[model samples]
Target: MDLRVSLQALMGRSLTRAAVAASVAAGLALTGACGGGGAGGDDSLTVGLLLPGGGASRFGQFDRPLIERKLKELCPHCPAAFAATPDPAVQRQQLESMITRGVDVLIIAAVDPELLRPSVEAAHRAGIPVVAYDRLAQGPIAGYVTFDGAKVGRLQGEGLLKAMGAKARGGQIVMMNGATTDPNADWFKRGALSVLKGKVKIGKSYDTVGWRPENAFVNMKGAVAALGAGNIDGVLAANDSLAGAAVSALNATEVRPLPPITGQDADLAAVRRIVRGDQYMTVYKPYKPAADAAVEMAIALGRGKSVESIATGTVDNATTKDIPAVLLPSVSVTVGNIKDTLVKDGMYTIAQICPPQLRSACDKAGLT
Candidate 1:
């Protein structure tokens, strides 16, 4: 298939189909040696993986394993080192340690993009190419892979409006945005505001510290008290974590009928919440294509080759222009299409999403 055609096909496809297409593209890039200029076909490159969170977080539960699996499949002889931390300082130290250890390349989903700029530059100075994964890190990055932030937010915004129905007309809502440290949060907020502004009243807005659910919980509690749970008609939460927090705060404050809430990262908990009529919807960005793209870019860069063959697009960061990038598409998931989206895509099984506790709800949603 023509590369242009292949890239176009990747958009709007189911998770399983897109992943297969991406794998085929990777294979074509490898066999054709499209941009071979460095140590060609060197499979012994060492890769260091850094993530923002672990232990039940999306990074730990999905991305880390997916990246590792793709790396092994692409470069079986390569040794891969991994680390995860939510602290910016700790992540910087981990990056420096990897630099000292002389990993051939690095893949990092930075906790704080600005804070990690210096370290990313240092890695560049050390001749180690960095592949920014999920989160766009600052400095000289070889390539980037993530879902389109603006589109994700737009989906959340549109979903919230649809859920609100009659309430959307002049109704008040709380905006539970993610931490400012992450640029994607700002991107998502902007995209959502583009759709939400002038349509509904934003009564209360918060930039959740550390993107922590606890902070979100506190902010949500304050919003409930100030806005009056009865008056608040909707919530525009940045991700599933914050959405969960918002729901908890509303429940705690004795908000009888939960308002429509928006979320990203179609987490299992968030999906369950959707089934149970807690969260309105979630944005599901398939992890496999993202992981495969990152791994493909990292290997190509590690071998001192160009990523032109693997990268389907380009993105500009604070310190770099025209950086090779692969921004994948995302899906909007709700109770109405859980089986068609998440279950059919194999992100979760019917049984896993519709546990015994949610049996009745699942049946009503047609999950059975």
Candidate 2:
């Protein structure tokens, strides 16, 4: 039940046992007393991390660990508590749990941003500021950190068009998008449409809820049913997870020499898919920079200091005004730029991203 324990043990630790009777009493008093920002005394720090889904696997695999490590670096003696639940309702409950436990600052990737507003508001009322990570969480937040999602979609759209080649206009493509609950999903869809609307015949479109691969598969199957497998030319998948689902659906139907498919998040599997020529491109948002930016922002906010030095610009959530944000660039990763984007940025090493299974593909892609 020790809060100082590693995050892998959070589930095992009984939350009730960790907060001593005196600790709760003191926390309750602090809730009533201090509401203004600029941080409490630096004697101790508690940072609560709230991530959305487990489908992508990146949050737990990369983001969470990095955030925890960076926060530790900033405050070695401080406690970094983590809570990961896929359900939006569960996420709200987790945030409240963190707030009640007296977290100094919260970093959240809300599953359902709109629904989580009340929880975020409750945190603000308790003098705990929330930082929207990846997905924007509404309400009075301290800051935001994410990649340029619109640019990610734009790159996907452009890559899809390029891969469509001479069949461009005549080639019909289905679009499988991310959940509409997250504003980033909307931005991604909008950005892709900006380039794709007039150019290609959009066969069918469906938004995957919870960014679930099964949802993508079902929607893609529906698209294939409506448009006919042979008529479909390309597919624009919002992220690597959805793209993998799309690929699975296509393979199930025996759709081979697959039409160009575009995706975001240069996940290891996605990179391999590209090398194999099944997936055309993926948008590579440098994970290191994104993780570093989030860490820097969290540390700054934890210390009750201005994040202007780290913020590249600003972004708007529904309820929050111009929130300070660190927006990183996204690069289009095809076979041609695999080395330049993912490898050069140190998001993954050749061995990590390309395994023995993909050795020949890696060689062909010039990644070996």
lDDT agreement with native, every candidate: 0.84, 0.77
- Summarize candidate 2's per-residue lDDT along 1-368 as a digit string, tens digits: 00010111111100323433433232221211223233555546667778764434888777877777676666666666666767787677677767767788888889998899998999999888788898877789988777766678889999999999987876799999998887888889888999888788888988899889999998888887787878889999999999999999998887866889998878888988998888999997766666677767776777878887777677666676668777777789899998887888777798986788889888888887
lDDT winner? 1
Clashing pairs for predicted structure model 2, backbone only = none
Structural similarity to truth (TM-score) of each candidate? 0.90, 0.87
RMSD of each: 8.9, 9.0
Candidate 1: the clashing residue pairs are: none
TM-score, prediction 2: 0.87
RMSD of 1: 8.9
